[model samples]
Target chain A: MNQKTNISQIAVVGTGVIGAGWIARCLAHGIQVIATDPAPDAEANLRKSLQQAWPSLEKTGISPGTSPEDLIFETDMAKAVEKADLIQENVPEVLELKHQVLGAISQACRKDAIIASSTSGITPSVLQQGCHCPERLLVAHPFNPVYLLPLVELVAGEKTEPAVLTRAESFYKEIGMKPLIVRREVEGHVADRLMEALWREALHIVNEDIATTEEIDAAIIYGAGLRWAQMGPFLTFHMAGGEAGMRHMLKQFGPALKLPWTKLEAPELTEDLKEKVINGCETHAGNKSVTALAAKRDEFLVEVLQLAEKYWPEPQSIMKK
Target chain B: MNQKTNISQIAVVGTGVIGAGWIARCLAHGIQVIATDPAPDAEANLRKSLQQAWPSLEKTGISPGTSPEDLIFETDMAKAVEKADLIQENVPEVLELKHQVLGAISQACRKDAIIASSTSGITPSVLQQGCHCPERLLVAHPFNPVYLLPLVELVAGEKTEPAVLTRAESFYKEIGMKPLIVRREVEGHVADRLMEALWREALHIVNEDIATTEEIDAAIIYGAGLRWAQMGPFLTFHMAGGEAGMRHMLKQFGPALKLPWTKLEAPELTEDLKEKVINGCETHAGNKSVTALAAKRDEFLVEVLQLAEKYWPEPQSIMKK
Candidate 1:
């Protein structure tokens, strides 16, 4: 499906970093954007975020032009969704807020318009529960610095239409994203849940003084992490077996299966733990502002994307049996 | 310390892929190398690997112009280690063979010369148990394509000398590696254990027909694996928390902590499993020979190393408390 007939006008609700990012990305790819957020300064904030996003996008040779002045920033949600082919909701994580936004967008947008939520952990079913037309609602979770990172987890809720998912996938591909359809609906989808497990354990290690945040980081980036970037855990281990392969590796090291893992039973969010975490992050983060750190992250993400694109060009077509 | 005063010669006692890799890295940084292997054509093989390694090294500007002519390959272990400052043993992973080679190298090399094993999983203490001078022997495990990847796990044996560890660390730094002194000796040191866990699980998935090898690889590389290249498990999670940090992440999803991981207990190396593994690798590997695959791996590794050097330059001095 080509972009002209399939995806043209896109509505981005809630002009936060993610919302503004969607607008920037869509506009960069020549898709017209209509954005909405409740706050009085939301339009101004989105304008600023878009301005900052433009140069980086330009560096990748995909400019959204001199100014996003052609983009519409509507205060009314209905007006924002009126002429949109796709609605990307970036509202807050609260169930009540999501229900309200999705319902409003569904009522105003075209019957076939794909409505995708940018929720990281909330399941599609829960978010679609309050939608007037739940069939169009699905989770399309993108990583931070959305314009750069290629992954977008497309999850279908119980009520999501199959056609909605196919159209959403096509839209993502057009905008330069690698979308993986999660077969089942689980909390946190696929990527976030696995990440949550490692993260939870990492926190426990930090709390227990087994390792500092920096040390824990060093353990991955400088060690197994370098290999992980190029190949996943399994292929890496497959090679680790020398010529013997995975079975050999497993058989040799199988006895250590019962070693205690650091996967902590989720701790109660005590006030002390909160302060400890904040302080820990602040110490390593130094005086750099959040915007600055984000910009730095985006810069690195761009480099990594360029490298991957150069090495692994996508297969032209999938051969079906 | 500058290179002049701390000038050292190294004996690379194996002339295989790893041994030649060590030679390339050491000599590129201006250290003299004495390589040895019992294979009649070991010198020829070493020359071939070096020729393959040069272009990438040159691109990184780390190749010290010394030719293969500068390297001395001998069949005699005594001649190889006679006056060496450091002896890196990359021999086959047989205990009896290691014992024999290490004993000879220990007897011939200078008393102060640190003898380091390139064993990925074998603990140094066990390897050094039969050595006459066990105090000088330790494990200096480098990842595959050692010349490119910066990480080198330096694990000390029970009888390993503290001074020897210090000297090895300094030497590793001089040759441009991020040497981490693993505090406790564990099988596979640190990285291998984590790799083994993931690998064992992957084999189980493939063995059970849950996922194909390529699918599992795509799951990681397209998802969590990409983030890992730049940040570790903890830092990446810390960022995942948005403004709430790790505590919020843990508190939200800690209840699922007890869910059984798919990480299989190492499988039995049955004849069938071995055959399956061999055939699986062969089919997936396609037409490339082992040497060809190794060469491809080396090329990618060199590119990654150059990129890493450009982005994350090793700090001259770490802050000390």
Candidate 2:
């Protein structure tokens, strides 16, 4: 829908962590950003986040002339998107609130302006309800610390135009993001669903008292986690099968699928299990706070990402350089 | 059992990929290695793998006097373990073969020697069915490119001495491995089961034709895969939940586990799906061969592992440094 419209000026609604991350990413790409949030301290928080994210984001590589000074904030929703080429809504997950906010933003934006939601699980169709121009609404979900990660999943609603999807895809790519066009709408989208499956299994492991949080983390961090960083389960298995690839792997170990390793439904998060999980996390946290761990994670992530780009260079990233 | 045994000389039975990997890792760590295999081309393949692995292993870091020339392969298992203080058996996954080979290795080695089976899924209890001294036997599973990945899951069987587990842990650590002492022995051990679950889900996605190999790979490499590089799902979601941690996440969306996103039973890998998967992989492979991808994976894995060591700073790896 917005394939041809140049998204030079972008409006980001909701200055939560996700929204602040978006602002940092956009600013790093040299985009003029206008952000809006109702929270009393939203502007200050956004500024703090940009400062915190600057060091790692620089490591991720920024466009020439990128600066934090280009960012501006407004409290009024209509005033925020008054001149926006694109609007990225990052409000809470409540469906009704999202619908109202999206509808209001649509009323403020121009006909060609693309409006996207950063909803992790909610479908784009639901977000389009009561919007003035439903054809321009879509989902452009991204991970945390959005400036570092190259992925951005774009999901199109039923009322959305195919042209708009293409436009959004091109725009996202132009900004140095890898846009994964999810084939169909699902509760958690593709990646989150797969993650949820693993998450449920992890919960089952801890809930059953079979292993602690630390053991589960070790089971991944020291092993499979390393592999997944570069390849998915499919290609990974294809490699694991040796020269023959995925077919050989399927035939050899297909029967193991029947094993009761994963829980289809999540086990109840009982008080005891919660306590054990909390204690386990505290033990593993050691002297590092969550913030420290997150910073370390981000630092290594930038290194890993830079390493990835070396082997598999992307055109968009190259364009920025 | 082998707590005090001087593991200067190591016997590697069955010089397949896993065995060659173990040999490469051991030799790089400056351990004297003797390997045995019955296959006519085993020696040639092992030599080639050792040559292929050295460059990356060197990047992983090596001891003062480590060299490929220190590796010796024998045709007879008894001669191979003649002076070995540690024997790593990597025979095929066949239970009967493992029983025979492990039993024979135990008979040849000293009573204090530790025998480790590199069985991916088979239980140590089953592998130790007819062993001479099962007390010194346990499972020490490592991922592919074993020279780089720091993880080594050590699982104990019924007859395995608790002290032997501790000894194996220390020995593995001495060799620059992060040995995870599996609290209890189960099928596929701990990491493999988690990997298998993801593997099965991947197979299902491919079988249903929901997404191509490249898409599924994209879904992972760009998304959940990033989080996995440093922390497992428990820790990842704990961070995702903001300040309240895992409890907040569990309470927020624990019910999404019952969604139809993941198939409990892997869809039958029909001929069509196999062709598509192979074709998809070929497409994703682009102009590169599996061998090429593997080499690149290893190169990047070495970098990732090195970065991980910098943060975690494992004693074994640091000892070599």
Candidate No. with top TM-score: 2
lDDT of 1 by residue, A1-321 (tens): 244347888899998757877887788878888999999999998887687666656655474353566688889889989888889999877789899889888889898888999997788999988898899899999875565555688889999999889888878878866677776766666555445445444444444434445544555665556555445554444444434444444454333333333222223334443333334333333454433433343343334434533332113211000
Give the Cα lDDT of each candidate. Answer: 0.64, 0.70
Tens-place lDDT per residue, model 2, B1-321, is 223445688899988768988998899888889999999999998988788677666654688778888888889889999788889989887788888888789889887888999988888888788699999999999987576666788989999998888778878888877787777777777777666565555544444444445566667765566556554665455555555444555456555555465654233334443343334333333465433443343344445544543443123311112
Rounded to one decimal, what is candidate 1's iRMSD? 16.7
Per-residue lDDT of candidate 2, residues A64-141 (tens digit): 787877789889999999888889999987788998998899988888899999998888888788688989999999
Question: Which residue pairs overlap in candidate 1's backbone?
Answer: none
DockQ per model, Cα: 0.12, 0.19
Q: Native contacts recovered, in order, as a fraction for each?
A: 0.22, 0.38
Interface RMSD of each: 16.7, 14.7
Provide a comma-separated list of chain B TM-scores, one per candidate. Answer: 0.79, 0.81
